[model samples]
Target: MASDYYITADNVFEYSRGNSLFDGLNEDQIKTLFSISREITLGKGSYLMHEGDPAREIFLIIEGELEISRYNAKHNQNHVIATLKAGDTVGEVALLDRGSRSASACAVSFCRLRSVSFDDLQDIADKDKSIYSIFYHMSRNIGERLRHSNDVALQAMEKQLDEFKTRVTLGNFFVYIVIMLSLFTFSLDGLKYIMTAGKNSSYITLPLTLAFFVFFIFFIKTSNFPLSTFGLTLANWKKAVREGIVFTIPFAAVIVAVKWVLISSVPHYMGRPLIEGLTAMNADPKTWWMFLVIYILVIAPLQELLSRGGLQGPLEEFLSSKYKVPLAILVSNLLFSTLHLFMSLEIGLLVFIPGVYFGWLYSRTHNLLGVWIAHALVGTVGLSIVGF
Candidate 1:
């Protein structure tokens, strides 16, 4: 297309009458604008503006079509924003902010446009009394474009978020199945413990259980789960202490109640793990202190880290896929309760309350330190009450 595709002065009156920025200007003002504005032509497939170029001019499309597009590194491409036509205004934002161009525009067909540089606009605003009113008009157009751009960006963001959720759901599903398999194995082993009554299997199975816990963490990590996923973090230690103390108060009450009921109601012929485990404490005072220390430190952290942190966190996430928060909590609660199956159904049922409560605390806090401390304190208190 030739440079004179549109004559600058020929349509000055017509453009000023209807064009947004120049509208409402008198004939003298229109003539003055026409004197300074340039007429430019772009051949098909030629760029009119580029992103990051210095903002200098605004354009009034006189004839033919152009397309607006933006580059996104994430998609590794330019996404088309709009297809503009004649009488449509472009580049008004340049006249206002005079910053870098946000998007690129290219002519789709041979095009003619009236262009007014910022310097020309500034000169007109300085000389003419009426030119000051164009700012609001330019701002309104920029706001519209911003809103449109935001809508496009928002749609893209929503799509990305949905994809991320799908990935997380698939991950949780795999982790959930593995944990269930591990629990099933543990339940079977508990039966073996009950049958043999710890006579010959102490050295082999106990060490194996410890090894299983280590492998369980490795297994979870291999699935891309972090320890922090189970709310295990030393970050926000003060908040953890407060939550631990708060959780422990009710926890202590529940522990005392459970222990009281167990002692008063259950008979003493028990050869269950807790009883048998605590019986070893009676060997001597040194052994008793050592057992208490180990219980408070090693056993308590490991158990809560397993059931509440590791098991409950992923299990709840798994159940929450198709269920509500209540059902998710309930399912995890049941799974935690089953850990005591070797003791009795009654004991399993009894522990379920604390399991649910502890899981709830972990969910609310998202830090295991609180629940770990509460679990340790409650376990120690409960064992002491049982004279273990």
Candidate 2:
């Protein structure tokens, strides 16, 4: 009764012809193929194989269409190489050779596929010489198609790469012009301030003047940007808090050790007294509590939310995998350091290093815990010794 089910032989054969390899197979052969194969269904836009993944099995599309794409390094794009309709067999060559997949395959529509593992096919080929011939031919055909696709992709990428280079050159020219204008404005303002105000006025103006310089520097640095977005949102606040605590602990420990070393090594001077006072405050139980509260409740959650939470997800989608982690950490570290600019340069730099470390941890874990523990530990230890 199941054999006499609504799924007919004519339907199977018609589907088989959609694939080039099965083009020559008769209804009996299609039925035999179906007997040996397992059916799989995929939703539209689902991946069958990812680029660089080991090809383990060949897929025969029984219904719908599949899209094949290869990563093109020159254009930094995933180039669509082919559209495969029903009955097409893909990954035969890579499966047979046990090689990395040169192209990725995704379902263009809801797809029904029959998959035959390399081992199963090999067993069949070993038993029947004719089957081996068919298998060999199918593998060769898939290889040829893949080669042709690569060639076309390369040619298209070359053109795109040239266009991209030209655009970058033009963009940089405009950026340089902007930087020049900013420098001119700053120079004029500095001259006017100096002429109108006394030496003490220069000290009073120093912070504001430096702020402008830093703003311009940041603008310039980020002008020719790759992907940099923050994805953390208010919904992720709970997760960020968890991450922040994990990050602060170890980070605080390291900070404590570093501060202790500095206190032991640095000679007593005006700056030393201040540093000593800060270190002493850390030893106080009240100071420890305050430091813990500030780091865990205030700084960790806020910083992670800003750097890793919201728009960062979309920005990361556009970036090359290799550049993503570094960029995230760098941007986060810079923001952290900028927030501490009002503090002493030495203290700011000290905090900046730990901030960078924390950022790296956040990027690597995609969780806030590691960085939070590091931060809290370092802060608690450092402040305790300094008599905070």
Candidate that scores best on TM-score: 1
How big is the positional error of residue 22 in model 2, measured in Å on the Cα after superposition?
Answer: 2.7
Candidate 2 wrong stretches, greater than 4 Å: 1-11, 14-19, 23-27, 51-54, 70-81, 100-103, 168-388
TM-score of 2: 0.39
Q: What is the lDDT of candidate 2?
A: 0.59
Clashing pairs in 1: 231-368
Kindly give the number of clashing pairs for every candidate: 1, 61
Q: lDDT for model 1, please.
A: 0.69
Candidate 1 structure quality by residue, lDDT tens digits, 14-70: 656767766677877778877887878899999999988888888878888989998
Q: After superposition, which runs of candidate 1 have C-alpha atoms over 4 Å from their true positions?
A: 1-169, 172-176, 179-183, 186-191, 194-212, 223-227, 261-283, 315-327
**lDDT (C-alpha, whole model) for all candidates:** 0.69, 0.59
Cα RMSD to native, each candidate?
Answer: 12.9, 14.3
Per-residue lDDT of model 2, residues 88-148, tens digit only = 7778767666898878999888887778888777776676555665676686686787698
